[model samples]
Target: MSAKRPVRRATPLRKPVAGTPAWVMPVAVVAGIAVLIAAFWVIHWYTTPLPPKPLSQDTTTVVVSMMTGLPASEFDAVGQGTANNLIKPVSGTKLLGSTGKPEVFYLGAEYCPFCAAERWPLIIALSRFGTFTGLQTTTSSSTDVYPNTMTFTFRKAQYTSQYIDFRAVETTDRDQNPLQTPSTSEQKLVSQYNIAGSIPFVDFANQYVFTGATYSPDTITGMSWQAVAGTLQQPDSTQAKAIIGSANLITAAVCKITGDQPATVCASATIQNLEKTLK
Candidate 1:
C-alpha cells in the first residue's frame, strides 16, 4: 500500500510578468515618498505665521519707536527740505469736515510703492499728535515697481487726535484688487489736485498736498521692516535721514494747520526751524 502512492507532479514556477521589471516596486515606493513630502510642505506653507504680514512682535516694537518722537539732533541733521521735492502747497480750498478739527486725508493703494514709502513718515508725523489703533503690517504689490516694500496699511486703522482728523482710503489691496473705494469728496479732491492721477496723494487740511513719496522707494527696497526701523534711531543712517527728515517736514505742515496746538511738538526748535522752510 505504501508503494502505491502516485508520484506527485512538481508544480511549475510562475513566470515573471511579460513587460514589468523588478525595479517597478522601488520606483513606486520613491514616488509615494515624494508625494508625502510635498503634502507636508503645502500644509506647512499654509499654517506658518509669516513675518511683517500681520504685525509681529518685532514690527510692533518698531512701530512704537516710530510713534515716539526722535531726538532733536536727528531732525537737525536731516534738514527741513528733505521732503520739499515731493510736497506741494495748495490754497483756497474749504475745510475737510464739519467736525471743527483739521483733517488730513490720505488716498493711496496698498499696491503702490510710492504709498509704501510715504506711509513711514506719515505715520511718524501723525503719531506726534494722535494715537493709531488697528494698524496692520503689509507690503506693496509683488508685481509692481519696488515690489514687496515693507509698510503699514491704514485699511483698518483709526486715528484719534485732539488736533486733527486722519482719514485714510486704501483704494486697492496688495494684489492690486479693489479694497476701499474713494468717496465723492475724495474723488473730487484727487481730480482737482492730483493732476497726474498718481497715488500716494495726501491732503493736509487743503493747505499742503503731497503728490508722491517724500523719498525714493529704492531707499528701503532691500531692507527688512526691522532693519529700516532700526535705522530710524540712528540719526546718521541714510534711512534715518530720509525718514526723519520727511517726518519733520510733515510735522511742520501739520503744526501750521493746528496753529501749533500742542506746544510740546510745535514749539520744538527743530520743528520751528523746519516750519520756516515750508512753502
Candidate 2:
C-alpha cells in the first residue's frame, strides 16, 4: 500500500566543479605551441635543401684564384723575408727530385682551421709556380672554430702544369665531407714528410711537406676566412713570426724541390742553417 509511492531513482550527481583552474589556459597554449614547433621543424627539414655529396675523391678540379700577385706591403715584408729563405736551386735538379710528376700536391679540406691559416702562405708560394684560376677564398666550416666566414678570391690564370704541376688533393669537398681519401701514393707522401693525418699538407714538387704552422691554432684566432687571410698578409710581423717560421719550413722544403727557383725566405741563413740538421 504505502508501497508504490515509490522508489524514485536518485538522479546522478555531477562532479563538484572546483574553481576554474588558473593555469588551464596557459598549459593548453604551451602544448599547442609545442605541437606547432615540432610541425614547423618537420616541415622545414623536408623543405630545406640538403647539402650535396661529392662524386669521387679521384676527381680533379681546376685551381682558380682572384688574387694575382702579392700586395706591396706583403711583398716587401712577408714576401721579401720569405723569399730570402730560398736558396738557389742546384743548377740541373728538377722540382720533384726523383719520382712523381712535377706537381704541387695540396692536401686540405674546406673545414680545416689550420688550412685556413696555411692556405695563404701556400697561395703566396704557389703563385710563383703559376696563376690560380677560378679559386674562391671562402671561409672554413661553420661547425669549426670559425663560423660563416668571408669569401676567398677566385680568378683564372695560365701556368705550365708539366714541370710545375699543381695537384690539389682536397681531402674533403666543399661540403666538409671527405673527397679524395688519400690514395696509396698520397699516404706514402704524407708519411715520408712526417705529418699527421690532417689538412693543409703541402708537398712541393714531392720533396717537401709542410704540416702546419709553428704557432698553435690559438695564434690567429678569427671567425672567418677574411680574418685569417688578413693575418697572413703580415706574415713577417712579430706576431706572425711563428707562422712565418712554419711557412719558412714549408718554403724551404718547396724550394729544395723546385731547385729554390722561387727564392723562398726559408733559404735564408736562419732557415738554411736549420735545414742543415735535416740533411
C-alpha lDDT of all candidate models, in order: 0.81, 0.50
Q: Per-candidate TM vs. native? A: 0.76, 0.53
Cα lDDT tens digits, model 1, 91-198, are 856445546798999999998999999899889888888988778778887667887888889999888998999999999998788999888978888888899998
RMSD of each: 10.4, 10.1
lDDT of 2 by residue, 1-279 (tens): 355566789999999888978999999999999999999989877864332232121221221222224343443344224222322122222334233546666777766766655655566555655555545555555455533333332222223433366666566644577656666876776666644565566666544444554344545544334334445546555434544444444545555555555444444565455455334
For model 1, state the Cα shift of residue 76 in Å. Answer: 3.6
TM-score of candidate 2 against the unseen true structure: 0.53
Model 2, residue 242: C-alpha shift (Å): 6.0
Error of 2 at 93 (Å): 14
TM-score of 1: 0.76
Name the runs in model 1 displaced over 4 angstroms: 1-53, 57-62, 66-69, 81-84
Model 2: lDDT of residue 10? 94
Task: Give candidate 1's whole-model lDDT.
Answer: 0.81
